[model samples]
Target: MDRLKTLMDWFDVRLGVREILRSNLQGYLLPRHVNIWYSLGAVLLALFTLQFLSGILLLVYYLPAADKAFVSVERIMNAVPYGWLIRTLHMVGSNIIVAVLLLHLLSVLFMGAYKKPRELTWLSGFGLFNLSLILCLTGYLLPWSQLSFWATTVATDAAGAVPWIGEGLVTFLRGSPSVGAGTLGRFFALHVVAFPLLFLGLVGFHLFCVRRAGISVPPFGPSARPAGVGTTFQHEVHRDGIPFFPNYTVKELAVVMFVLAGLVAITVFAPALFLPPDALEPADPFTTPDHIKPEWYFLWAYQTLKIFPSKLMGLAAQGGAMTLLALLPFLDRGEERRPFHRPLFLTLYGLGILLLLGLSIWGHRS
Candidate 1:
């Protein structure tokens, strides 16, 4: 033990590993009132790590060709050792990460944690969310199954409705007038290469901003500190808050373990339950599925488009909603951070959540 400690001390002296950890994790002061809501960031990181590793493994066997993609997936499932588990985890992790990220966004918004100094943090997070969705869309097409192929067809066709530039966008996305091998290759490149790099860069910046700005204080709790008061808040936390290493890390670890265990249980017991046998079939461009739909994360938007009279109008509305969300930090120019304090904002946000849930359910049924 002494010899091992001596070796570690030697490396730490040379690499400053202990110093980096001290500055970033152990010495960091999180708001005492922060609860499980804050832990969603860690959970997201965990899911992303799983995705990164599983995706690399999947790429080893995946063939990005219209003729071979579906067959390759089958081979991965049946022939490759432990490939089924990795594929299942990747699929399940994609859905769960989106769900958790949405919840985290809502939590941050309701708490008004995006105000003032943390604007960039919110922006970076929003960027990450959108990139994750893009990653999902790109990966969805990788299996080249009926569900994936048809879903990509519908999605790109929708993109082609973007007024004057729509044609070019569709051509660029599909690499042809139709979904074929070119489209598969493009999406595969995006899913495995482009999106991951952007996501990682944004994640690094987001964490840097978080570390620099520190976690937002609870707006309603007794430990709440006023916004715009910088060093004073730090002083209070320094005096009153618990050490993040043992106190908060322990809670975060528990949450991570619980979520991981739940994910593993679901993946093991009913892997790919969400995907039907029809969806697993090879892509057939000639015959469209009777009732084709996107993944559940996009169902709300899909339902909204169905409800609207004009396709262009529906597309614009969806795009406009995302734009509004991205620009929320600048639009919501109030110092108030608590939901209870901002009644009008809270009401609107609540209604938006309700509408989203209602649309998702309607889309699922329709």
Candidate 2:
């Protein structure tokens, strides 16, 4: 231990590793009022870390060819030691990450954490969110199961609904006219290479911004201060808040452990039970399933497209909705930060959540 500490001290002298850790973690002053909501970011980081590790292990066994992809997955589950556990972690972790991201986004929105100085942080987070979705989309096709194949077809086909660029986009995404070996190869390249790099980069930048700006204070608690105060929230936090290392870190660690336990329980018991038996079959282009739907995260948009008679209109609506969400920092320009203080915005937010929930349920039923 002394030798290890000496080596670390020698490295830290040249690399400033200790300083970086001190600034970002040990010495960081978080708001006293930061509750379970603030732990979402830590939980997300933990999930992404698990996903990255498990994905690497799975990649050792994954085959990208259309004919061999499904068979390779089966071999991994049945033949490779503990490969089933690793695969389950990757699959279930993807869904769990998405769920946690939604909760984090909602928490930020309700807290008005994106206001003023934190706009760039919010923008980086939005990028991370979109990248995660793309990662999920690209990875979905890697299994090359019947469900993945047809779902990819439906998703890519929807891109062709765009005005003039639709066909080109579809061709680019599938690497051919339809989903096939080329599509699997392209999606595999993207899932394992491109998206992961981008997600990691964005996550790094997001964390830097969070550390620099500090966590947003609660908008309702005793530590809450109005937005226009000459003194920034960061200053107030530093003055009266607790150091993150022992106080807040404990809570965040507990949350992460609980989430991991739940993930393990679900993986062990459920184990892709939600996936239909049809999904286990290899792709058959000649026959189409009776009901085709996207993953639950995207079901809202899929349902929205179905509601509109015109494909172009549906495309436009979906694009506009995403654009609006991405530009929320600008669109929701107001001095008020608390949800209770802003009834109209709060009501609109509630309605939007309900609408999305209703659409997801309806899409699943359909």
TM per candidate? 0.95, 0.95
Q: Write the per-residue lDDT of candidate 1 for residues 100-163, one digit (tens) a residue.
A: 9999999999889888778899999999999999999999998888899999998898887788
Tens digits of per-residue lDDT for model 2 on 235-295?
A: 3346577878888889989999999998999899998754677677888877777787788
In order of listing, the candidates' clash counts read 0, 0
> Model 1: clashing residue pairs?
none
